[model samples]
Target: MTDAVLHPDSVRARKADVPVVLGADGAPVDWVKVFLGFGGMVVGQFMAMLDIQIVASSLTQIQSGIGATADEISWVQTIYLLAEVVVMPLTAYLTKMWGTRNFYVVAVIGFIITSVAVGLSSSVAMMIVFRALQGLFAGAMIPPVFATAMTVFPPERRITANVIVGLIVTLSSTIGPTLGGHLTDLLSWRWLFFINIPVGLLVIFLVGRYANFDKGDPSLSKGVDWWGLGLMTAFLLSMQFVLEEGNDEGWFDDGMILWLTVTAVLTGIAFIWRQLVYWQPIVSLAPFRDRNFSLGIVMTFVTGLSLFGGTFLMPIFLGQVRGFSSAEVGNTMLVSGLTMFLSAPIAGRIVRMMDLRISMILGFALAAWAIQLGARVTDEWGFWEFFTLQVARGLGTMVAMIAAQQMSVASLPVTMMKDASGLINLIRNVGGAIGLALLTTILSHQTAVHYMDIATAASTANAASTGLMDGLTQVMGARGAADPEGMAAKAMSAMIRREASVLSFGDAFAALALGCWVAMALAFFTRPVKVDTGRPQGGGH
Candidate 1:
């Protein structure tokens, strides 16, 4: 294999005398195997993501079914996300402690078990606990899913693998709500949990059958960073508390939020210090030394805001504001999911040939454009506009996401690959949670401001919009048709409320546009690397 590097026109570089293999640089790889492996991991990933939103969609029904309050029902989702975020960093260690194979197997099984438990549960508490448990073990599914595809395929073939991976991840995130809603509406809400059973079992069976590979135990072999794990978990938990409950508690006004804020800060500082100073960190921080890895985190974080935030907004806006059924919300999001599936592989293909920086730049450009499209929401807008925007977002997501994901790992040492992937993805998950909470709160605030603004404007009684009292009378009549006088008063109030909703939704859409502007900075952080191939110009395969 003694070969000299020679530039080539077909690709960036060509191997001198390496064995000519299929999709190995210039050779094609075992794409069928790679896609099968990638697809299996994606199934696992989609199931995990589906769980997060499925709970939210089912909560109202579950709440009534189980006799729970709004606060109590929130736990269905909160528990899953909390477990998912908490388990994310831990999964890296588990992968090393066990092996990627054993880890994924265990993860898939645990997910299936929990999914079933959640479905068969007798009470909400039991379901929450099982859901949390599902979140915990299933956390191992994501990063490893990507790593499996990368490992199975050669460099040239990496594009194909990522396209599949990207499609799965994109669909899981974008279409989760739609899928959740469908399962909830047509079937019992419990079907959401039950659905994962068959899919997860299939994934597990496939991995056992085809995706077999070692998940090296670096912790036992490498020694567990016990102290680091505990500290990081504490830090994440504290931060989550602040973000999840801050608005409810009036920000700093609540003692619990204040305490959690302080704990998060202190624990976070300690965690970082231990990582930098310790010779053997719990989760190694060296991969982050790669500028690409750091940039990847930034990109994933900002991108998460748009991805998760939009997904959260649509259902709530459609259902809470427009009074659409759960199924309708699902149908709306299905467009985004399908579009992402279509766009990912294409983005993956071109990304391999393009400069890392160039691909990332283009990806962000698409993402920014998508956000601009979403910023024009109106109460009266039809499904087509929503579908168009979601598809654009989906397209932008694949380009930016896969580009960011691949570039981050390309330069890392093979040994740190799995852990590094986990860390970068951990940042993305945390970012998604934070994004959801932040945007929801922002949407809430903006809606209020817009509502009041519109209400104030209407008080004087314009030709187009009557006074608030008058609008209320008309809406009350519509809402409460039993008593004429009472209905008139209620109708008047409801008209004002509908006007408030329109203004609020518009304001929320505009507010989210600002976050996309911040995410555009991710393009700047990416380093430009010239493309390289595994060959010399005239070398034989």
Candidate 2:
């Protein structure tokens, strides 16, 4: 019944070799230790998720403090994401070599140290360096928590544990912008990093003392695949650089972007080649061969697109068009985050009562509808108008995440659990990066197109344009302006541009809605998981 007997040589199987604190009659340990251990891992996962989005709204303030140019300030996020994606998929191998518990504890401590260092940084360069370091450690900490859900817990509890983990992953990113906005307004941008200290320390203390489920393997230390790692690092670094900077620098036009594109292509091929041939690959690619897992990865990708696309768009819309403050923007999103949290139990119940396929179909339908509704937004709309959209997104997120997660790894062999967790998370992050990039590119292109058309129409002698100009001129004349027509023209142009921006946002939302529909179609490809027998059944090892 133990993992050792089932998998024999799984890294998780090695966990059985560790000395466990026994309970009554040498029975399995109580839930207290499991809860403590799981709780600590969850905190670490929370910090990792929070750190990525925490800077979403605070970039402007941090830029001011560090005297960074706009381009340099954007790298604050790019570097962290780059580091995270680069390190994420390799967690399975690293944890195997270092031992899961030891690697996790060290990553927590390192993440905390880097957080303090980032807060103390005087220049943008220093901050970027420290944040990259923070991301490296944070990325390593995340996958293990999910792997723990599958490998460390008993079968009956795996579903519950996964839901809890899923909620943290979804909610942390959901609340990130809001939390960052408040801390920046109430204190300083540095407080964002400093806030992690106490939480990180607490997680460290608990994990260090109570986590005895996973043990390290010294044997994996031999024959470490440094070449595969080097190829992976190169590929991720180059690919992320291109994705993050391609739009600003002019996609294939910029020499740096062009060269990085070539580099990424080459390294990506090489990494895949290495993984296929290497005896000790840095990241296992075998999991993708499973049809269900492949569908699950695609679903997770769409999940990232929905979650990250919405998260990226709302604040920009509020800040630019409506002139809302960071605090206000965060406050609007806080409701959605709470909705996601409150809806987790309902999602959990759905997973237990309904088939994952049905639950996922319903989730995707709701999410697509929610995003489609945002395409109807107008410049005058406020928080109340966005309420339904937010609530629907929150509920949809909970259902989709819980279902996708359970479906992703439910059928993989126990030995492949670590690989499944790491690769699935890697896909999610990569999907988010791709989604944000795609949405931003669309917004920029659509805004320019809309602005040009609006400006062209206004320059003509159309009745609507002329009437608007005439009204503005009379209003300005009544206000005692000398050049009423000129002032009116300028004001009218501004109005046109603002409307164009709003329309551009609508286009972005529509695109995301289409993405959700695509996810819905993919949900049908997922074979039903029958759970009515009171025991979860997975595919063979």
Clashing pairs in 2: none
Estimate the TM-score for candidate 2: 0.90
In candidate 2, what are the lDDT values of residues 232-288, reduced to their tens digit? 999999988888888888788899999999999999999999999999887999888
Specify the highest-TM-score model's number: 2
The residue-by-residue lDDT of candidate 1 on 175-222, one tens digit each, is 566667678779888898888878888888776665544436454656
What is every candidate's alpha-carbon RMSD to the true fold?
5.7, 4.3
After superposition, the stretches of candidate 2 with alpha carbons farther than 4 Å from their true spots are 1-27, 174-178, 181-188, 478-483, 531-541
lDDT (Cα atoms) of all candidates against the true structure: 0.69, 0.83
